[model samples]
Target: MRSRSAPPTVRDVAARAGVSPGTVSKALNGTGQLRAATRDRVAAAAEELGFRPNHLAKSLLEGRTYTVGILTSDSFGRFTTPVMVGIEDALGAGRMSTLLCDGRGDPLRERHYVQELLNRRVDGLVVTGRRPDPRPSLGRLPIPVVYVLVQSDDPEDLSLTYDDVQGAALATEHLVASGRKRFAHVSGPERHWSTQRRREGVGRALEAADLPLAPELVLLGQWSEAWGRTAAAQLLRRDSGVDAVVCGSDQIARGVADGLREAGADVPGRVAVVGFDNWDVMVEAARPPLTTVDPNLTALGQHAATRLMDAIDGKELPRGVHRQPCDLVVRQSSV
Candidate 1:
C-alpha cells in the first residue's frame, strides 16, 4: 500500500506499471501513441494506487479555468431554484464549479455581478431569469454566455426557454379529454409574453375541438391567489355552467378551487380545474391535487449549460431562441 503521509503520484504509478514516467503521462492524457496493453496497464496501476490528478494544475497548463458564473434575477424564487439545480447537476459532471450571483432584478446589481465574475476569469457565464421575457443583452464578453428561461434582445446571443403555448395546449387538451364542454380561462396580465402565449394556446385548443373561447369568459388578472379568487367569483356569477377553468398558475388554481367550493360547485364532479407551472407545493397541497402544465425548468437549465459548454469547447452554436417542450401532470382536479 502507498504511504499514508501523501497520495500516490505519477512516478509511483509508472513504477508500479513497469513503464517510463513520460509514457505514463502520455497514456493518462491520451496524447501520445502507445500500445493498448501499455495503456491498460497504466490505468489499472493508477486505479490500484488511488492516484488522483491535480485538475487545477491541468487547467492552468491548458490556459482554461474550469469554473462558470451564473447570474440570476431571483435565486430564491421557485421558478429559478429548479433551473439552478439543473445547471449545477450538469456542470458538476463536467468537473466544473459555479459562482452564483443574485441581481434581484436591478440593472446596477447585475452589472456589478458581471464585473465580479469577469474579474474571477470564469470560463463561461449563464444568465437566468424568473420570467421568459426579453431583456437587454449583456453585451460582448471574453467568455461564452447562454441565457436561461429568458431571451437577450441581441440577436447574436443564444437563449433557452419553455414552450408556454405547448404547455397550455396540453393542459387544455387534458381538460377537454375529461369531457369538459363549457370552459373559461383565468390568467395573468396580458402584457406578459407567457400570458399571451398561454391564452392563445387555450383558444387554439378549443378551436381544434370545434369550440370557442368566448371573450367574456376569459379573465385577465394578476398572477396571484387573490386574483384567482376574484376571477373565479366573477366567472361563476357570469356563467355557473362552466365545466372547467384553465388557470395561468398553480397558485391561482388553488384560489379557484376554494372559490368553487364556496360557490357550491363540486370539484371534478361539476367543475374541473387545470393550472400552469407544476410547482409541487401548490399542486400537492390543494384540497384535491391540482392538475397542471410543467414548464420543465430543470430541463431548460440543463440545455443551457450544455450549450455553453459546447461553445466553450470551440463548437459553433447557433444564435437565437431555443424552445424546450413541456408536458401535463394529471390530478384529481382535472380527472
Candidate 2:
C-alpha cells in the first residue's frame, strides 16, 4: 500500500495499467490512438489509485485555461439558475471550470463583465438574457459563444430559444381535447415576440380543430398576476361564453384561476386554464394545480454548453437561432 503522505502519480497508474508513461499520458489526454481496452484499463487503474492529472502541465501543453464563462443579463435570477447548473454539469465533464457574471441588464456592467471574463482567458462564453427576445450580440470576440433561453440578434452568432409556438399549440390542443370550444388568450405584452408567437400558436390550433378564432376574446396584458386577474374579470364581463383560456405564464394562470373562481366559474369544468413555463411555485400554489408548458431550460443550457465546447474545438456549427422543444404538463387546472 502507498503511504498517505504521498499522492498517487501517473507513473503509478501506468505501472498498474501495464503501460508505459508515454502511453498513459496519451490515454489520459485523449491524444494518440489507443485500443479501447487499453484506455479502459488505464482509466480504471487511475480511478482505483485516485490519480489526478497535473492540470498546470496539461494547460501548458494544450494551451487552454480549461475554463468557461456565462454572462447573463438577469443577474442570476430564477430563470437563469437552472441554465447555469446545466452549463456547469456539461463543462465539468470536460475538466473545465465555470465563471458566471451577472449584468443585471446594465450595459456598462455587461461590458465590464465581458472584459473581466476575457482577461481571465476563459476558453469560451455562454450568453443569455432574462427573456426569449433577441438582443444585440457581443460582437466578434477572441472566444466562441453560445446563447441560451435568448438569442443574439446578429445572424452570425449561434443562438437558442424555446419553441413557443409549439408549446402553446400543445397547450391549446390539450384544452380542445378536454372539450373546450370557445377560448380566450391572456398573455404578456403585445410587443413581446414570445407572446406574439404563442398567440399565433393558439390561433393555429383553433383553426386546426375547426374552432372559432375568437380574436376579440384574447387579452394582451402584463406578464404578471395582476394583469391576469384584470384580464379574467374583463373576460367574464364580456360574457363571451369562453370555455377555455390559455395563459403566457404560471403567474397569470394562477391569477386567472382566482378571478374565475371568485366570479363563480368551475375550474376545469366550466372552463379549462393552461399556462406556460410550468413554474412550480406559482403553479402548485394555484387553486387547482396549473397545467403548463415546460421550456426545459436546463436542457437548453446543456446543449448550449456542448455547442460552445464544439466551437472551441474548431468544429463548424451552423449559426443563427435553434429552437428547443417544450412539453405540456397536465394538472387539475386543465384536466
Q: Which stretches of candidate 2 lie over 4 Å from their true place?
A: 1-6, 35-37
Poorest 10 consecutive residues of model 2 by lDDT?
Answer: 75-84
Write out the backbone clash pairs for model 1.
none
Cα RMSD of all models vs. native, in order, equals 2.5, 2.3
lDDT for each residue of candidate 2 in 26-102, tens digit (9 for 90 to 100): 89888798999999999999999989899988888888989998888886477898888788888878878988888
In the range 151-188, model 1's lDDT, one tens digit per residue, is 89988998889988888888898888878999999999
How many collisions between residues are there in candidate 2? 0
Query: With candidate 1 superimposed using the best TM-score fit, by how many Å does residue 258's alpha carbon deviate from the native?
Result: 1.8
**How many clashes (backbone N, Cα, C below 3 Å) per candidate?**
0, 0
Worst 10 residues of 1 by lDDT: 72-81
lDDT of 1 at 244: 92
For model 1, what is the error of residue 119's alpha carbon versus the real structure, in angstroms, after optimal superposition? Answer: 1.4
